[model samples]
Target: MSENTQNAPRPIDIKLHQASRLLEIKFDNNTECMLSCEFLRVYSPSAEVRGHGHGQEVLQVGKEDVNISAILPVGNYAVKLVFTDGHDTGLYSWDYLYDLARNYESLWIEYLGKLSAAGHTRKNLS
Candidate 1:
């Protein structure tokens, strides 16, 4: 196997707090990443937002009310998010979480811009 594939993250425990809108992900390697509901919703890996390919992503709107209903494990690499209001198709990978944690400011700004364009506001998805 390639080195890149061998070093991929494998989360051991994933906890989601609805009231706080926080997801505490603990990787097998002991690294932790804290992600917010708005952050996850905005950066969902779903085709609805990621589009079919690069540069075609449709920005999410009114995700302020989006909440994670469940976190379903996908083998050892990712987890499926069951969102409140019954929309669940996003498969969030560990790499994606890391990216979100690292680029929070940019991603947040992007989400805000999309919200403004769509005339939407994110309320606590509690």
Candidate 2:
């Protein structure tokens, strides 16, 4: 494998906190991050979320109460997240998850800014 692939971070464990709607990921390098379900939903890597090309992105709303229903392994490289709202296309690789953890604060702020700009609010999904 390539050096970049060889150095990719691996998840050691994943814990779901249903009540708090948080997914805690522990990495092999001893780093851990607690990601909100809403964040994951909004930042989904699926085609529906990302769209077909640059600037074609679609904003996701009303996912504040979204929760991961299941996590299916896609191989040694990635895992597919099945969300409560029936979105299951995104295959989150280890590198992508690590990047999400590293950039959570900025990404979340950006998401909120976009939502505000679009006059959208997080509604109850339950």
For all predicted structures, in order, the TM-scores are: 0.78, 0.90
Each candidate's clash count: 1, 0
lDDT of 2 by residue, 4-69 (tens): 465877999988898888999999999899999889888888889989888999999888888998
Query: What are the per-model C-alpha RMSD values against the true structure?
Result: 3.7, 3.3
lDDT of 1 by residue, 1-126 (tens): 122355666677788988877888887677787787767876878888788988898877666657788988888667888888576787777777666665777878877887778887666532
Taken over the whole model, the C-alpha lDDT of each candidate is 0.75, 0.87
lDDT of prediction 1: 0.75
lDDT of 2 at 68: 90
User: How much lDDT does candidate 2 score?
Assistant: 0.87
Predicted model with the maximum TM-score: 2
